[model samples]
Target: MAPKTIIQQESLLQYQCELGEGSLWDAVRQRLYFVDILGCKIFTYEPSTGKHGYQSFDRNVTALALLEDNTGLLAALQDGLAFISFDQLPFPPTNSPSTYKRLNVDITHLEGFNRFNEACVDPSGKRWIVGTMMHEQGFPGSAGGGLYSISKSGDGLTAELLLDQLTVSNGMGWTKYNKTMYFTDSLRKEIGKYDYDIDTGAVSNKVIFSNVDDEELGVPDGMCQDDQYGIWSARWGSGKVIRFTPQGEIDLIVHLPQALNVTSCIFGGPNLDELYVTSAREGTTAEQIKRHPSNGDLFVVKGLGFRGKERTRFQGSFLA
Candidate 1:
């Protein structure tokens, strides 16, 4: 067997967000989008121009899905989902909030003290899967954080509950064949696999894909899969990312020394060989922040000899 190759990680940006998550890359426009959950902001970056900017929101924005038409982003906000067009950036272009319209689907029934956490578009581009977690004091699977599915078609947006009893529903990814779906419940410290149906976007046969000891490897957060089906998991407290095979075998690990909280990650760059990482500065003391200044910054890993799949866009007329 050939020797293992070491991947190099470097800080790409220095914008310290309180809780940065969800990194999505738009290949056609060559732009990268991410969110600062605690800071209540969404960020955009252009590598060619070396420009980094953000847009503020009244509520926490957890995740974002690139629109199929590449015109805007589908945002999972504190109240519900919304469509944010690119034309209103830098400023709203107008003082009116009409540029950011919340969908008709109401998630307040599902969110008691918690809000939407992490979300992604399904491989078919027709279904958007979002997960939530308890924002206050509670153990894992407590406070009624659950998984939800929002079907988007020409008709409109409709929401449905899929699973309940979760503390922090984090990373999610699907196998290349779209037959297996992997989901991470951070509080449970386990990644669960489900038999997935591409036609209906239904999942069943839930089983354990991998388990992490919080004290040992840290809680599993955001995740993405490479073209080879290797699942790359961003570890929260451990400040690292681990690569595992579909069978749950550890293959490689990438460590970020400049960060204390590794929130999420995604594959980007021209060829999708680059891994963009996001971290958090929340719950840290000023002293700790002084020590690690890049805590809430964005980083990237390149020269990994691996490439990741392009993010699936949401195919919905709601944003049209």
Candidate 2:
């Protein structure tokens, strides 16, 4: 067995978050975005100018994706999806009533403790795939969560349920060719691979791509793929971001010593050679928090000698 390559990480932002997830890189704007689910905040940071800001909301803002044509951002709130124009939001954002244009998608079926989780855009930028999870932790197969794909249908938006019975539908990404798709069900402790059809926005031939049987290594949370077909998955409780080969083999692990609950990661920076990671301090004990003071801070891993493809933006139309 080849030895696992270990890499060190550095803190990028000291802004504390209860549950910092949904790492995204807007290549066109050269900025990074992420969300604090429990904090109800969406943060933005420009690497070039060191200008960091955030927009707070009354409800949980779990995930975000850039919109095509630079219209704005597609945000996954607690109940449903919405559109937020960054140009309209103030710099050094305030906790004003969220200025998002809520999309007309019926999510009342996901009542009770269920809420939106991770979301991503298809490689072609034609569809938005978002997942749901129960607010409280439930056993595998116990939670009635699901994954859905949203697209523009004529003048309005339509949502198609793709997968159901998920405990925690988390990260998702596509291959460079858009022929393969990867998704993570955190409580299942595995990542699934599927045959992807970009034209039809469908996934089939689902199979377990990687399974983390060791509890100490933590479950797979959020992930992004590289140009070389490596899946970089953030391990929730292990303070590690692992890189798995296309064949489901571990090739590299990036360690963030101060972050025990690593949430998500994405590639950014001028050359796209850097990896930006988000962490959580939500479920930590007082002692654990004391030990890892920067548990909820964002971090970056550099000098990996590899890069990722630019993420696609949501091309769907917004509600008037």
Candidate 3:
């Protein structure tokens, strides 16, 4: 189960990304950050200075976290979570958070396209993001969707409300003693297991970590986790990428090419086993986008063990 490695390069921004969740790994500039939510853009890849950076935003940023004083936490295109810079946020991919913080998502379900999808940064740095709907209209937990925990101290604290009506509030994991918090809602293919408290951030008991097959792997958006507690899901339309464990067991299967839909994967370079993948032709069917012409590019292979820990968010306690 190892034959999905394509970074061959060639793009229309990898074919107008319909959804290319977060593929993070910016361990302080080692470089690799992503999001193409409808091509609103915010991508940076520095595979050792092959240097590729682009930032264009007005909303559709999806996710971007790094603020242990690194400053750059913008997840907006709708439901608010801003602290951007590049000079003040029209598309400031770098410096511009001298002071800017807007956290606006707690909608309780009207679901007229409330957005914000796929996020990470937990392990006491809090910023476990999720608020999803509007993939053509959705509303999962009734709150239009759930999952929000922002408290590194930016002032807007509403942490822990982890499941709802559901369209796609995807892939997240933390259990190397981070106390356990695994999540995914790829149209409810189901993948959940929570029992975290991290001194009161709260995420109590929610077991059901694997109930997939989304028309044959095209329903579990994004995910990453495997140091020993495996769970790697990305089967958008069955381009395939699966691995599950912790007694819900369904061990391995990684095969992407002609990418059915694939979107999200992380296990960075420099010993993270390097498994970075993100793909999508957003609602494909130009003959499945010409039978998968790298359906939204970017892929890598060499992941077997597990290699994470480069996530940052909780940035609030004023550097507490």
Best by TM-score: 2
User: For each predicted model, how many residue pairs clash, with residues at least 3 apart or on different chains?
Assistant: 0, 0, 22
RMSD in Å for model 3: 17.9
Candidate 1 pairs with clashing backbones: none
Candidate 2 at residue 130, lDDT?
Answer: 90
Q: How well is each residue in 68-96 modelled by candidate 1, as lDDT tens digits?
A: 87778888987688888777554312333
Q: What is the C-alpha lDDT of each candidate?
A: 0.81, 0.84, 0.65
Q: Candidates sorted by TM-score, descending order?
A: 2, 1, 3
Residues 1-320 of candidate 3 have per-residue lDDT tens digits of: 44333332333234346677678776655667777877767677776646565565655677766666665555545566666542443322454323445664343543544677777777777555555554444443343555666543345545455555556677887777878788887666787888887777677778887776547656787787757756788778877677766666665667765566888887777777777778867788888878777787777766355555455454553222
**Cα lDDT tens digits for candidate 2, 141-205:** 35667888888877667888787767788989877688988999898898998898899887889
Candidate 1 deviant stretches above 4 angstroms: 1-10, 90-99, 106-108, 111-113, 153-155, 214-216
Error of 1 at 226 (Å): 0.7
TM-score for each prediction?
0.91, 0.93, 0.32
Q: Candidate 1: worst 10 consecutive residues by lDDT?
A: 90-99
lDDT of 2: 0.84
Residue 278 CA error for candidate 1 (Å)?
A: 0.4
- In model 3, how many backbone clashes occur? 22
